[model samples]
Target: RTHLDPSDTLELRSAADARQQWIHYESLTRDLSLSLTEQLRLILAPTLATKMRGDFRTGKRLNIKRIIPYIASQYKRDKIWMRRSVPSKRSYQIMLAVDDSKSMGESGSGSLAFETLVMVSKSLSMLEVGQICVVGFGENVKVAHDFETPFGSDAGPKIFQNFGFEQSRTDVTKLVRESIELFRTARTKTSSSPADLWQMQLIISDGVCDSSEHEPIRRLLREALEERIMMVFVIVDDVRNKKKGESVMDLKEAKFVKDESTGVSKVKVERYLDTFPFQYYLIVSDVKELPGVLATLLRQWFAEVVESSN
Candidate 1:
């Protein structure tokens, strides 16, 4: 064994601690990522099946399943036979915005948020749907990953290396505006395709929108809507330690709560969300529940796409 000074020993121990924490985070998220990936893949598979391009009219090939209906029509319904086409692959574009405010470092929220980002981003990217961009925001916002690069190739290492929770406050509105510009830049650099219709932004935070920027967020929401970009806020509300009798909000939304102990956790969230609400929002107790919540959200969205294709 080699002898070392006190400073050198302390430095080595600090490095060991950091490495251990990194492994802990990575291992925790890896399993969740795999589970979510399989769930999403199954949900998306149905959409890849034959979709009706036209029916009750002329088309390339007649669907055999419709023959019975065609015959029952007494040959009057020529359009009973359907024109069908199967999409080779479904593609999508998604952006993930995570709040890295100082508060995030509280109650282990920062670790939870970081794990959420890695799991969701990895699962989605594994599906090979399209590119995903990630942004971490607090007093300021910056891209953790850009749309120009592949998530696995470049964004992965950059995200893992650069994650820090040193911001003083959260600025939800600023993040929204910046994302719009980022999207615009992305559009310019890439060729237009059907995947453009699937563009979406998911903002993840353990807190509600900044009430100070209420008006600015309202304005930005309109622009985001007009652009046909889907915006979803995944709000993580930690109600685990709350008193059993106390409610997050009014008891009305409580009726919908699956947790009898919590009563209406999301109802309380609903009030805060009013400041900067999107039509699509999700609530969960912690980042650990994200695998299921995210899978359900994507399944619902993909279902809509399948319906529209018909």
Candidate 2:
């Protein structure tokens, strides 16, 4: 959905008013996020309906076998029992890289993307899904918020609102490369990291990438995939075109190959997406649909994490 132009809609007399509005929005977002997360958890990983019961074999329940030994000595807790049905450890980090180039703003798609990011980020934060980071990229990369920032805070949104998308070019390769470095550094600093930690990168864009940067970006993505990092490329398009395939002009439409002794032949193929190493989704720029798509993806992410943990 096209967002109202802040220049035309916002009439703030003072910075305080702006701050108040930001706070109000943040609170509302947090509440919405919490609700969404609860529903998702129920659908994706419902708590076992079976009641907790004492197990004579081994569990949090006192071992009856140890009762005889305990009778002969002072009662003390022992490792004789295990935590029953303990939830698997899932250590994953989520980062969202938003395209903040001028063209994104031209159609007001950028604002819609920002809202989707903010809502999803807040919801994930409320669920405590994983360490989260928000990055905005145009000609340069900007870390709008990181795990250290308080979840559901207005800081990230504020930074996004003030960010100018006047850059002449989009450097997607630089953005991905920098994000890799950031993730590496973060993994080191994180305490009690899980054995099979995974990283999820969500790239929300119009799929506009400079031809010169495509190869490098592709290579970086391949490296990330090799390292078990999951990438989600979300292409925000017009609502009229809800079909999913790929962005037009995402790759060369026709390739000409010359035979050694014959004339050149043009080769046509479907989405060159297979050339890249990531899951791709084409969705309309609707605020409601965007968040639902992200939530569903998160559910799948959790399922994957559970599988990997096992």
Candidate 3:
């Protein structure tokens, strides 16, 4: 129902080119919010208006008010709850583990990763998620920022550049083991255990792990699973078909590979997949889709928590 004025310049060479561009642009704009409810009403009147006015006593009539609540309830059921000690307090902690390897830099993928992380982090802050700690790793791990309070507008780009330096390739096995050990050591050093607080760890990586000498990551993952820690893995790659091409193997395949020489387990492969525990895995072809994907994921997650609270 929305019409484009002839005077509206699409900055294209000709009207034909403009028309073609509009088609693509319109698809993306389908998910965007309209300026006013009247605009939406005008567009839907011809088709949706008739459906909305059908016999309410029958099954065909659409009750907008009831329909909204029903859809909202469905979303609420999909969220995951984080345990907290204080009944009145509503917040959760998120730990981010970002891979900053030489390969990421070479492919110019680090920028994309950084941007995606920044967007997620900022969005979480707006949702009033509690303390957030961002850790960047290559050969070593370093804290980019630990925000007790929400990050400001200038914080994201600054934090991105602060930990943007590239190092050696990523060793998932070693990184997981070391990060877990680091957390335990820090907890011990403080002599304070906040057992009531819920902790969630999220890892962003390309899944191309480092060499075979690294220790098994699976063992650490098993421990995390036993501990009931919430873990998420965001795998960024363009891998479509698994059979015809090389793809990052899931935890099961990544571990317990057979060796023809001595019929022994492949230690390197075992270490990488087993050490890092991931409850949820999200695979995306590119970073451009990350923002929308993350928004939807978080909305689902939060909706559940909100419903449970009520």
Q: What are the candidates' C-alpha RMSDs? A: 9.7, 7.4, 17.2
What is the clash count of model 2? 0
- TM-score per model over all chains: 0.70, 0.68, 0.52
**Model 2, residue 31: displacement in angstroms?**
8.0
Question: Per-residue lDDT tens digits of candidate 3, residues 49-112?
Answer: 2212322333543445455555678844322222222223333456788888876665555544
Q: What is the lDDT of candidate 2?
A: 0.65
Between 1 and 2, whose TM-score is larger?
Answer: 1
Model 2: lDDT of residue 261: 72
Pairs of residues clashing in candidate 2: none
Per-residue lDDT, model 3, residue 217, is 57
**lDDT tens digits, residues 221-301, model 1?**
889866756678886655664445322232121113356786744433234445445656787666668878877886786
Order of candidates by TM-score, top first?
Answer: 1, 2, 3
Best by lDDT: 1
User: How accurate locally is residue 243 in candidate 2, as Cα lDDT from 0 to 100?
Assistant: 40
Q: Residue 48's C-alpha lDDT in candidate 3? A: 24
Looking at model 2, residue 211 earns an lDDT score of 49
TM-score of 3: 0.52
Worst 10 residues of 3 by lDDT: 43-52
Instruction: Report clash pairs, candidate 1.
Output: 56-79, 57-79
